[model samples]
Target chain A: MRVEVRLFGGLEKFVKDVRFGEGFPVDLPEGGRVAELLDRLGIPPSQVFSVLINGRHASLADVLREGDRVALFPPLGGG
Target chain B: MGKIVRVDMTARKVTVEEVPEKYRLLGGRALTSQVVHDEVPPTCHPLGPHNKLVIAPGLLSGTPAPSSGRLSVGGKSPLTGGIKEANAGGISSQKLANLGIRAVVVEGRPQDGGWYLLRLSPEGAELLPADDLAGKGTYEVTKICRERFGDKVGVITIGPAGEMMLSAAGVTNNDPEGNSSRYAGRGGLGAVMGSKRLKAIVVDSPSLFNAPLKEPERFKAAAKRFADILHQHPVTGQGLPAYGTNVLMNIINEAGTLPTRNFRFGRFDKAAEVSGEKLAEVAVARGGLATHACHPGCVMRCSNVYPLPDGRVCAPIEYETAWAFGPNLEIGDLDVIGELNYLCNDLGLDTIETGVTLGVLMEAGVIPFGDGEAAIRLLKEVYQGTPMGRIVGSGAAAAGRIFGVTRVPVVKGQGLPAYDPRACKGNGVTYATSPMGADHTAGYAVTANILKVGGYVDPLKPEGQVELSRNLQIATAFIDSTGLCLFVAFAVLDNPEGLPTILEMINAQYGTSLTVEDAMEMGKRVLKAEREFNLWAGFTRADDRLPEFFTYEPLPPHNTVFDVPGEELDRVFDF
Candidate 1:
């Protein structure tokens, strides 16, 4: 299965060529969890604060389906 | 002894009086609100002679405390028709504090309508004829004041928008770089200043950290601990320094609470194009700073220098302003956003109110959506004092009424900010019930609702929202009084020692053994005073509501409407 992943708030530092919020497709097992996607991107789960699957909050154990849009962020805030 | 300088604009006389004993513990919003409630008649027209403008520095403003240089400007809001305390970051707060001034109260308008400037220094406070400075933009007014009164002096001034008594006009003060973009940019306090025929105030003080401290050594130690706490937080130490407040663009967009295109959608397709990442990239590429401080002793430095392509600079384009001009208008270009931000700063207008007004105009078919050039042209009309410009400056609610657009996103006549309350229910409760009327900083529930800073609360759920907003609003009222930047809450919320460390600094400075409970009580007192003032001004439970559309309009992605019950909103100030 293939899923689109985006990084933000300096989480993009884990991937060499990806800019913040730039999405890239990644191949994953049929029922891969968010933790598995983070492992594939070489980003430590500790560095990621919030994960959103298709614009809703998701956890590391949540299963991802094909064509899912995943966004990962570091601990960030502003008003 | 701290002094309160009262300037009678009607008589053109200035009198310096001792601070009242009751107001000794109060500072910033606490002091400003108390002064406004006591002096200004509740039912008087906000722009009339009865309204008095109170300017104050926070309790720790001129002390060695880090990021404690906030200034509070208070008045009866011309827009909201309620008591207001608009806060800003600039050098004037520290200057005023160091000069031993607790607050400056401007009362009674000049019958002759002659312009004047209040010059303050250690020698004395005096009103000077400012006819030469009339009709100038804030940037020019600040520059001229800086040149006349040493470059080190801090200048607080307004532009033609204020002079024209626009409801959206805001009071602005200069940063260290002399950029007059540090605005108390809400509730239309600038119009109150303009109505008094006061053009500017130049605070001339040589000392920056000479405010009397009761326990100097203990205060210094506590201040150090607070600074370290800020530096240790990733949000303040790293993310903010790298990209400023605009960093929230992507996360908020991904969270589906960005409020795109006048709240028609929850997310903007090109949000990243104007995100903090893009802002940093373009700012650095154009010989501008990606990180800067708005005032001295600011360790977080979550401000930037964005130099536009037109050779002008908008010193710090904050998250709310960017969202207002960019995603709110469906305009993705950062340069266009920068231009609009600069125009607001120069015109002394509230950027959020102007953007929301422009959105209402677009909905009325006065201008096309996503037309950045047209938006810029329309904003420039405020300088010309045209009818269209007056309508624009009257804010979103007025524009909506004039154009017959019922989808206006406002509470208490002030416009809603970047976050859509439909998705962020905790903030929704705040927008509805806060005395300040739709002000995000009044009680930023985004900490729990979206950012997961203090604790995690489901953003889309109505459960636990009222309690979340209530607690935050109380804590925020206290913090706003300390002259500390609200961003400090990011660190304070996560760390157990944060609130105590802050109290320790305050206790050491004031020689008062105030506990966490006393601080909480103080916060409650501030809110109660504000709420009581609002009630006296004829605002009832009906006025404490989000616009009707927010209840029915389900925002996209999460597909959530603001479902927080009105009865629960009434509970926000039950304390």
Candidate 2:
């Protein structure tokens, strides 16, 4: 199955499909968890700062359904 | 009479001008902003002689007001090329006010290559050649300047980074203990000071110079009430004084707003290792102070002096610093965080900017995440003037350029502090829309009660957050103009009558009848002025955005992307 993935801040360089695209629009294994998706995307679990699935909170272990959206964010410090 | 001190480097002359009639009503950030806007040409090169560096004490400085010791430094920013003000706690603001010096303007550059240190006192001002102070870090400069001037003097010194002129170099001010650590750290104002060939600014004013209260009894009574309110509040009076703002590390992490490992999640498994409570425990064991004040004449003492194992002191590891260097980099050790704080301070670099930039560098594979030692090693390179160091100190955006990473997290060229937008969308809006170039303190109106504005909306709720951010930003501008430390907002927010009391005190002091609405108007006016300056300085709406990463990537725990639509965001400054 396919699930859309989005990356923010410093992580967007690796997305080859678009120079600046929202939602990575990639193929993901059916019922993949965040951990599996991260491994597939070559993003070390440690490098990813925050994650959101369709505007809500999700754990790394949560299974992603087909057509579900995932977003990746960098750490925040605007002080 | 409050006087404006002017130091012209080219002539090596110092002059004192009486506070101009037009600026008498302004203080702190308001004063600095007005002075810069009135005097400095909008298109002047920030590092050129055309730019002027203005430092002013808030209206309440030296007035025994609660948390009113903020000193605002403003100039054309080398980082963003916009109007910039960086305020911080230190002895300088109060000393300047006590000396009846409303503001100090450093103008022009010296024709000679020699640097100078400008010293001020009740008697007069002096310009001393500081050739020996060149290339010296802030710590040595502070200690050496203090020894030459006397222990009683308050000092402001720049570090090696300022000399090299990394755009984020901050002006280091001595705390009560004379550590050259407390800083007016933002927007590369220090670079401007450095460009003026000023290595240090030493102030040693007698108490005879203190500003006289127009209504002494009213001032005393209002001050008493203000102190009483702060003493009665928990977050400011107790929690902050006891645990310091670092306490927020745990709470924010719990709320899933703490930016961890470059904002990958709302939570960090090792958050306890670098929390305020944890730091408090460590400070107690190491004979370090956890709840010390950052400046003189402050009731809400929220700063600290963290001691490393070598008995060296690393001052006040603020929450944003901890999150930026600790959790965001995956380095949970307080010792490392404290050391980084010291490094940033002595190097005259902005800690939050450097830390966030380092996280971006780590994302670029130049340094591995959670490598505290490697980060430290890289920091040394940055301090020593390597191309890599220059890139890092120039800020995350510059670092992105050198490393070929386009996904830099910056607003108007200034790096964001340590609050993840995915976790706290309210703060995210603030990050996107603040006129001060991604600054958190730009909208620190935690006191919804005093604003007489909207009631409490859960920080997590998206509705009304834009308005909340806007109101808070305006209110913050007003408070900053008062030249008071913003930590007072936490205390004032808890007390239903706290903000009114502040306005009352100002009203009583200024001999005017300014109401809360008028104050709000001033806040809006200041914001508008700053926005106009930024626009004139070439910042567009595209610059008024979060990194695209925030939109496409969802944060962990409370996984939320940047849901605030772009059109809605563009409507932020519509008023």
Candidate DockQ scores, in order:
0.77, 0.04
Which number leads on DockQ?
1
Strongest candidate by lDDT? 1
Considering only N, C-alpha and C atoms within 3 Å, which residue pairs clash in candidate 1?
none
- Model 2, B1-575: lDDT tens digits are 58999998889999999998988878888888888878888888999999999999988887877778888999889988889999888888888888888999999999999999998987789899899999988988899988988887889888988898789899989887888877889889889998999999898976622467777779878888989987876555655676677766654665567787777777787876787767767887899987788776777677777898889898888888998899989997989888888889889998988898998899899999999998988998866799888877888888887888766778888887877766566667888888778888887422231112134544555666688788778878888988778877766655777888888788777787888888888888778878877777777888778889988888777667877777777887777
Q: Would candidate 2 be rated incorrect, acceptable, medium or high by CAPRI criteria?
A: incorrect
lDDT of every predicted structure (CA atoms): 0.93, 0.79
- lDDT of model 1 at residue A50? 88
Candidate 2 lDDT over residue span A5-67, tens digit each:
756434555655532224556677777898898888777776554565654456678899888
lDDT of 1 at B247: 89
lDDT of 1 by residue, B323-417 (tens): 99999999999999999999999999999999999999988889999999999999999999999999988899999999999999999999999
- TM-score of candidate 1 versus the correct structure, residues matched by position: 0.99
What number of backbone clashes does candidate 1 have, counting pairs of residues 3 or more apart or in separate chains?
0
